[model samples]
Target: MNILLSGWQALVDYLTIARVISLIIAFFLSGAISTFMSKGAVMKYFGPNAKKYISYAIASVSGAILAVCSCSVLPMFASIRKKGAGIGPAVTFLFAGPAINVLAIIFTFKLIGTEIGFARVTSAIVLSIIIGLVMSILYQKGEEIDPNENMFNIQEENERTWWQNLIFFIILLAILISGVKHPILTIVFFVTLVVVLFLYFKKQELLNWCSETWILAKKIVPLFIVGVFIAGVLTAIIPETFMVKFVGNNTIGSNLIAGVFGAFMYFATLTEVPIVNSFMELGMNKGPVLALLLAGPSLSLPNMIVISKVMGIKKTLTYICLVVLLSGVVGLIMGNLVFY
Candidate 1:
């Protein structure tokens, strides 16, 4: 009964107003990308034929604009992948989206040491790109080309102009960033969104957007809830003392354990900063702390389940291994060389 109550409490804690709003905005924006953004546009930057320099650079650093958690970014990742993005850029965006978001980085700098904060940002971007390039090289030939590639070679006449779409996305992102924290800004953005929809978009187009959003929500939300509940149960079962004991030294084994634990555990948005700081206070090594920082935000049990459904078991497992390996190795380096 106590364990059950803990799990229930965790679920309640996870469903804060700000988090709900963020998820809603993420859902809508993902739907908008799928419904409104043209295949040609997605392909131009994220497709297989797209320039590696441009696609990897954009995907690697794109998280600066988004402040979502690992789970919140899944729908958008799926939307782009289905819309004709190649595996490499899609993977890059998936890892970078949550790992190096502006809020997370800033919070790390403020709560954690500036050294770890800078290291997290630099390592996340670099590791994401390396993982993306590796995945691209491994799977490029095996990637199934979209059958409609020829049709999307040119932008459809019905698609909104690029600048118009950009403005619309900016407004949506504003709502996401402000959320409930800035109620006034949220209201203003909402009103502007309505105005833009009425003036610039047709009723049918709006309906289609909502429909796509609903579809993504249906596919991801149920699994997300389950994953969250399970994660909560794990948190209740795994004592913090046990984790702290093993990770108190800056060794390869400790770093690997931290990386693996972080990969499977869920950390909501900037929550990892405080959690990691608390661990450091408990005598956790700087190396394992860095490992957790790298892996915690980018991958989670719920995140893994959802992405597996989107990308399949093989690709999902491979992504997980790369993230865990790289995070551990980097954390080890940071602990031994940079800090020590």
Candidate 2:
């Protein structure tokens, strides 16, 4: 009984810390992306008729910094697409946005080993470019739009200087680094940053920003809590030995299966880390570990429902399948080379 209680307590502590860190990272990075990187700039560089491969590279790299979850990325993706980004590049952004984000990568490294971490990053970048190229080929000659129509006209804010923005960015970075080392300190550091930023900015402006951030947090936090609870329950109920039966060794079949499962299973934003850690403790192999890391966050249940509404069922399903298959193949190949 004592041991069980201790385990439950540990789970709660970990979840609380992880959630705080994820929120801090998400809030600051999302704000920075909105402030510094204009949609117009993205369109100018990767607009229609841009070299297909170069556009793909740019889209992947840009998405890495935003580090938003799958759901949060949808609106931005839609806005960019509506504005006239080529189908290929737009899709690349969609894929890379969640897959290669800084927070996701950091969480991956922390939860899993560094080997899987690098694999996840490399696979995401390669898969993003491949997905873009294939999407481009499929949509080529289907539709085209004028670049000017697609340009984003973001209102510039003169209230905050570039130096102030830089300070916010630095504070965010420090919070992330500190959170990785000391979980509870993360909460303190993040709160400090938020308070400092608020004091520094005008009251009305700060209130507006806080309102927006809170709205996003409210939307996501409940879902996040539910996900953590589910994971904890699964950890408690499922026997590690049973899970080990399926993924004890880094077998090709196990890796592929894990990848496919990850692609299909709905992992809420930032939820994959805890769930993956649970699986690892259950004796899942490194190969399957990599597979899950690569595929989980990119596709989730809520995310699919939202995407289906936007792109319609057919295209959404097609996109989901392609991501799964590609992720599985990539994991299979990597597992064979690295683990075998």
Candidate 3:
């Protein structure tokens, strides 16, 4: 009975108007990326042959503006991958979107210690790049993009002007970033975006954007909701005492436990900081704390389910393993060496 209630409550909490609005904005932004952004542009920026340093750098830093949660990032991730982005850069963007969220990092610096906060930021960026490179290397054969491919033939005409598209995306990003936090400002930005759309974009383009967004929403949202409910049920049943007992020491085993636990748990946006602080007060080690921070925001149950649908089960599992392993190893290093 309690578990069922917990699941229902999770649904209730997640379906708040603010979150719903933010998610809708994300879907639209994702649609714009898929429909309006030319495939040539995507390939030039994130294709396999693009400059490695530049691609990874863009993928990592771009997350700063998104400030989204694990599940919220899926539509964008799916869009980029669907548009023929290389596995490496797409994966980097996926990890970075939630992990390196600017607002969440700021919250970490304020609520958590400066040292751990700094470690979290640096580690997430480094880990994202490393994981992306490794995945690209491992999956090279399957992901190879032929230059002559029809997908790459799609191009944007120079006459359309880049700045006009830039302003359009900027407004969409503003609405997403503002969310429901500044309802009036969000409304203003949304109205502006609508006006820009009607004036600057063709009717067919607008319809295509809506179609792409609806397709992504249909594919991801149902699984996202189910994963949230299951996570809530698991939250109700899991013993906090057990978590605390296993992660008190900074041993590799403890870090691994923390990493695995964090990977499967849901932490909405900036919530991980206060939750980790509470666990620290209850005797959690700094290493495991870092491990949790690294894994928590980037890989939730809801996140995993949606990612599996976007990529295949094999790739999804590999990605999960990589994140959990890297998080544990990094946490162990921080605890045993840096913090010590």
Candidate 4:
């Protein structure tokens, strides 16, 4: 009874107005990102034949814009890979797209701590690019360019113009900001969001954005709730001494375990933030937290299965090794820098 009550109390405390608003922001922005970034654009710069520097740079940061989860990123990864994108850039985009999105980064900075949030974004982008480059090198053969392909291929007839997409992103971002800021600023941004919505997005686009947001919410929200409940139960069941014993050390094995655990366990987008935050609150080492943040959003069991089909077993293994190794190394560095 005591354990059950503790869990219930934890859940109630977790569901603050601010967090609810943040979740809404994450869901809607994720949808907006999906709607705006068409397959053609992703294919153009990230295609196999694109320049290493330009393509990898774009790939590294693209996830910040896309706002997908591990599974959601798989389809995009498959699309780019199928379109003959270089193994490196596609893989970079694959890792980056879901792991380091703007909304999640902001939420992490706000909910977790400023330092870890910054570390999460920096390590995610840097590791993604490094993994891509390493994979390309190990493979030794860049993909062949298809010169006959049209550069301006449009995947959808109903896709909005680039400016329209920009306005939509800004308006939605303002809504997110409104949720976190002072009441006066919140009111101002809300008014701006309404005006922008009325002035810019057509009726159909508005509906499409809403529908996309709903789809993401439906798929992710229930799982998020369960995760929070489980986290609460964990708080009651797992003693702080035990967590500090295993995860508090900044040793290589500790970081490796964190990376591996993150890879195998499924974290539904921003849920990783709170999950990690909860663990951190319980005295989990900062280094392992960094390791988990680096690996969790980009790799999962389902994510791995689909990746094997998309890129084959050997390549998939290479990618996984790179992610885990890089995450561990970075964790060591971060542990020394931040907490040591």
Candidate 5:
């Protein structure tokens, strides 16, 4: 009874923290993205006939800046695809956008260590590019969509100046940095963001934007809470020995298995950090940790379900399998040569 009660308490705490933080970050980042990054620019440059490798490289860097989760990238993926991006390049952007981002890398470094942090970034970039190349070759003659005709443009009429956008970006960075240690600071940051938006834009426009952001939050925050609660329960119920037995040696096989499991498991945005921390306490090896880092953010059960609805089960499965295999292979090599 005591154990169950404690688990329940932990679940509530985790859910509260994760949901609040996720919502705040999501709203702020999404607003900033919609405001600053121009769709015209993206289409003109990364649109069709763009060099496959070059597109991959650009996508990797741009993705790092967005700081979104796997599911969050879906709309952006569809947008770019409609804007004339090839299937392979668009898919690379889809994967890289969430997989290898500055936020995830920084979080890993702060929670884990410098080595794992570097490895995670390296693997995300390399795999994104490689996967993009292979997918391009395989689907070179696949269905091509015209960007101008089909892309969704959710842009609002009001636009901010370049300087204002830059300022907003800087504020977001500051908020994220401060939120790492102090959760309350996030609230302050958000309030300040709202105030800034109100001052800069028309009242009606700001209200509409806030309403949309709230709608998105309502949809995602509840799921995030549930996920965190489940993670907490798993932490309390699962034995440490189980984790140690599989991922303790940083061995090639162990890392591969870990990668496969991570690919299939659902990790809500930023939830993997605490989960990985729990596993580390159980003596999970660095190799497996690397594998998990590579696979977790890019692939998830809920994400797969949603993707399958749009891309069909076959393509979704292929994507998931490829992520697992590639992450496992890279993690194995890095674990032995660099981390060992």
Candidate 6:
């Protein structure tokens, strides 16, 4: 009964109106962006033959537009990888597609300290690129491919006018950026987006966006709720002393533990932020918190399975190892240098 109540309470607390609205809008915004970007655009920017800096840049920031969790992003990642993206950029996208999502970043900044939030995001982006580069360099013989063959001929290329695109993106951005601040402002942006969708966008486009949004919501929201409930239950069961004794210090072992644990546990969207926050309150050190944040969303057991199927076991194992190692190093450095 106590565990049931704990889980129920967590579900109730997290399933608020504001959170629901934010989730819906964020998923819709991501859907719209992905539709606009298309397979061809992803190939152009993230293909193997693309300039290294440009590809990595795109990969490192792809999550801002994707808004998927580690496991959820695997299909998209595999699609691009099979479509001809270099192992490096594709791996970067795999990490960034979940790590740098807007909801996660905002929630971290809001629920945690400002500096820690910034560090989490920065370290995630840098480490994602590093992992990608290392994987491409190490697995070049098999992973290297021609970008031209990967490029698809998009029939809807440049279909929307520049102004239409600008307005669409601006409205989505406004809604997302303001969702964290004022409720009224977010509503206003949402209303404006709806109006633009009806007036400017084709009926088919609107329907497609809605379908994609629903797909994303169905895939994410359920797991996210379960994860939240489990996190709450774990917090209740685990003694504070245990957390402090094991992860209270900013040591190499502690950071590695956090990273390894996070790599194995699945986190959906912003779920990791709150779970890690609970761990922090239980006496987990700031550095280990960052380590968890860095690895948690980008790598999980389910995520690993999907990636292995796509990239082969050897490549997937190498990527996971790299992510864990780099995450630990970043957390250790941050712990010692920044906050201590």
Candidate 1 per-residue lDDT over residues 1-340, each given as its tens digit: 7878866776687677767777788778767766776544443566555676888987887676444457667987897688677789899999998898655675577557789988899989999899998888887777776744443255656646778888998998788778788999999999999998887899999999999889867866666566556546656676768766799888889999999999988776666765676567566889999999988999999899998999899899999999998899999998988987
| lDDT of candidate 6 at residue 320, scale 0 to 100 | 86
Candidate 6 per-residue lDDT over residues 155-226, each given as its tens digit: 455667778888988988788668756879878887888788777778887788788778876776777677
lDDT of 4 by residue, 1-340 (tens): 8877766776798889887887787677878776656755655786545677988888888876555666668888887677677788888899898888765687788778888888898888899989988988987474565543454254665445778667767766777766765677767877777787787667887788889889877887777777677677777888899888878889888899899989899888667877887788788899999999998888888889999998889999999988888898899899998866
Worst 10 residues of 1 by lDDT: 147-156
- Candidate 2 lDDT over 16-95, as tens digits, reads 66656656666656545544544554555566656667778878876665546776678877877777778778778888
Instruction: Provide the RMSD of all predictions against the true structure, rounded to 1 decimal.
Output: 6.7, 4.6, 7.0, 2.6, 4.7, 2.9
Worst 10 residues of 4 by lDDT: 145-154
For model 5, residues 1-340, the per-residue Cα lDDT tens digits are: 6556645675665545554564476465565564345644444446675555666777766665554567778877766665677767777777887776544565577557789888888788888878777777766677665645324333434377878767776777668667646768867886887677667767776566567567656655566456555556676777888878888887778888889889888776656766786677677888888889888888888778776775667777778878888888887888789986
lDDT of 6 at 26: 70
**What C-alpha lDDT values do all the predictions have?**
0.78, 0.70, 0.78, 0.79, 0.70, 0.80
Instruction: Quote the lDDT for 156 in model 3.
Output: 62
Candidate 1 residue spans exceeding 4 A from truth: 1-44, 147-244
Best TM-score among the predictions, by candidate number: 4
TM-score of each: 0.63, 0.76, 0.62, 0.89, 0.74, 0.85
> How badly does each model clash, as a count of residue pairs?
0, 1, 0, 3, 2, 0
**Candidate 1 collision pairs:** none
After superposition, candidate 3 runs with Cα above 4 Å error: 1-44, 144-244
Q: Give the winner by lDDT: 1 or 4.
A: 4
